[model samples]
Target: MIHSQVNPDAAEALRGLCIGLTRQALLAFTAIVAMPLAAEAADGPGTTSTTGKTIALSNSYNGNSFRQVMVKDWQNVTAQEIAAKTIKGATVVSANSSVTEQASQIQNMILQGYNGIAVLAASSSALNGVVKSACAQGITVVSFAGIVTASCAWQVNYDWSSYGKQEIEYIAKRLNGHGNILEIRGIAGDSTDKDISDGVHAAMTAYPGLKIVGTVYGQWTSTVAQKEVSGILPSLPQVDAVVTQGGDGYGAAIAFQNSNRKVPIIIMGNRQDELAWWKQEHDKNGYETFAISATPSISQISFWVTQQILAGKTVPKKVIVPLLRVDQTNLDAYLRTIPPGGVANPPYPKDLVVKIIDANTNHSAMPPVPPPAP
Candidate 1:
């Protein structure tokens, strides 16, 4: 009965319409399937802009060349961001290596309505109370170089313990697992100092013939390191090598030079002065040694990480920056790029920061160090 008056043209038109609808539906399904992959490819932690946030740097000490460069890098990077309208403002404050003073400064920052605070803490655990208070008020906190232990705060740090262990291992190898080492420690209460010292002691156990015959607090300042090393050298036996936390190597070398003892193998911390001196010595008498340091530019990384958080990016709680290392092969390359008296620090742009974030998120190896700035 339904087919009694069927029109061929009408039936054909209806079939065409159904085919078009089916094709459209298939396309819609395909688009839906591709949407997520497309978004994942384009989206990243740095995609969002932090256009109006304000950040602050609460540095513990401004005593050493490293800290000076750290602060300068932070200021320079933040100034660029401010000029670009990425952030509203950035302020830097340094305490005299005093935890009490640093805590007071952070409290002032909270009162001043800063959106984020990047801390180079005076004491890792001592700042927990102030850091927690900032987090409670919804302020983002990121610590680097000298990190804090607050669970809510994010940390961008070198593996300092591993740094120390690596230092000792290098010395062990250089001296054939037998030598008297002068350990030039950093600030007395600082976590960086303790971690590196602990690593050194732990690694020393593996090489029974190697010994830390003397230890001095360098305060991580060349002048202080030189003074302390000079003060203690009289009491110790001949030191075959000096293992140092950065900013102290050149000082240790100076102390040895001032005395009658020959300049032993001093592990450099990548300060320009240290590298220059090493280069001089190498040219004169074939001196060879290893060098490593947590780059001062890491402050820039912390600042960007803070900005990302403020921009609503989901970043990991801990991001480890690789330490810069120089040896006979690459020493000239590093020296050629670094400014005199500056540490071997590369500027960490937002893209690099994002890459670091992504790597940490995916639990993958970090992207390789970019070529030194020309």
Candidate 2:
């Protein structure tokens, strides 16, 4: 989720090799990395771990529910690993959504000689230089959720581009391929934001009849999204569908309801509030939509990956975690477990993490249920 407020006039710098990759390119990239990794090749100089090496988690923002759950999950998982003697202890450091501040904090972590670093990058490209430096210093850097483009950084994230395409395709199908739509985007200059936006644009191109009538920066928070959407609803003309990056869909729905306008078909994010509303709406009008998002639990994968890397296990440079999807059949099940404002999914399980580590280390297979736990 994005951290800043919307300010359309402000110019922002884009970072990293954040260019969109074609489906063919994505497939090719994944396939080429499917070979067994040698221990020496996997661990660069000084990368090997001792019995109790210290590691740290670096997060860019702590503003949203997703990030809060993400940090909590990271801390819980790290504590479990510590109890099991995987590492001595762990520290978590976060900065207010500034790429420069994040970079500086990461540099400080490197200087502190943390054995490994698990990071949720603030900007896809801005942290490249710092991540590379950390890797060069033999600090295993595992980036997740919002990924970094540094080749030296190990990435663990869902196929965000695919997520956008699938969700938009969902709405397009519901609309019979023709309708005015509202696009509530996340932060303006963030990499994940860019990737998801690219995916949405790609879908629009594929379905020529579908059009984005307006776009509002939601900053990926519910209150902000509600306020922004409320202000714009009066002007939008018959929006047939709503597309949003996760975390703000509920707010959008609220805005529509409050405006006394017929709510458009909205692709729900995995937040509990959204899912609960989705359930209620489904019962009332047979509203049908799937829930999807890059899971907050991805931080655990990053942590585990860092441990694997530091342990000299061969791993893929890019380990893609697939988007979690919850449809009508499983919606109730998800709702049963998730409390209000909770993420619909739990952290990836220990068994799944083992599967990922083994599969990637051997390069002989892929994990079952690679998506976040539903």
Candidate 3:
């Protein structure tokens, strides 16, 4: 009877072991079946989600609205991409208007193993060494707005020379090829500033009628521009027009208004507040001018180009983003969509960026002629 009981107990224990083994096998089968589906879910359509690229944005200055808007837009776009896992992450480093600090910051980014670096350089040529080092590590570097002179880094910018010439030409025509214009220049020694100034001077020489009566550095900030222009107003001659390198146009206009002088035909940069004021002035006195400036959204172009490069798409060493022009016809439209005191231009369309990548990927050098503005 005792032997019979032992046999029954042993048989029951054997049955329990078999049941546990079966449960473990079922779990293993489920995990194996789910692996591919899980991977597909992690990837977004048309993206190498597995690549997990990381990018850094390095800027030398953050005091102006343009840079502020640029950083914000970049954050918004990259945040979405990060959620989709198209890229692993993004970082922004600001040098507080110092080129040396910016260079060091990028060196750290490279050492941290970032896949790409996007920069609005503080100095056009100062950061070349670090940029080259980053490129040597197989990291992509893309610059925009205020570009770098590093040949290894890709550059994307609006045609500042064209911007200057066109803006001055418009004012020149309004002045009938002759006027004493006040030039509110951007930061002294900035590449963008130099290019725009060159364009303005070129136009002035070609027309032989427009004279730059006074010049002051606006430093690319509205408040600074207003104060500087105001300080210089008392000793200046009759200023019939104001040619500016984007940032100071609105401030320059305000200075004339504050002094009870007739507000001149001031060419405007694409600042939202500036555009709003332009529309109001248009309503009040039929004030008319065109908008041309490096849109802060040009940073988006740099961001996209960096992305394409990280994805193994070959891109041109230099790519040009066109100056965004907002005229009287479209002024109200921009005002309707843009925030009060925000930036004016929209983010670049994706389809256009794709075309740019496809067109320039094979270029061995900059085209002999400047590419037409898109």
RMSD of each: 8.6, 15.0, 16.9
Q: List residue ranges in candidate 1 displaced over 4 A.
A: 1-44, 96-104, 227-238, 371-374
TM-scores for all candidates?
Answer: 0.79, 0.78, 0.77
Single out the weakest 10-residue window by summed lDDT for candidate 1.
1-10
Q: Write the per-residue lDDT of candidate 3 for residues 1-374, one digit (tens) a residue.
A: 22232324667756655655565677678779877666444322224433488998998898866678888888877887789777898988888988889999999999999999999898888899889999899888998877888888888876678878988879878889887888888888776788888988887788888888899999877888899999999988898888887767788888889999988988888787788888999999899988877777767777778887776554667786667777787778777877777777677644566555544543323222122233
Q: Rank the candidates by lDDT, best first.
A: 1, 2, 3
Error of 2 at 217 (Å): 2.3
Model 3 gets an lDDT of 0.78
Give the backbone clash total of model 2.
2
Cα lDDT of model 1 by residue, 249-277, tens digit: 99999999998788998989878999999
Note the clash tally of each candidate: 0, 2, 0
Candidates' lDDT values, in order? 0.87, 0.81, 0.78
Most TM-score-accurate candidate: 1
Write the number of the candidate with greater lDDT, choosing between 2 and 3.
2
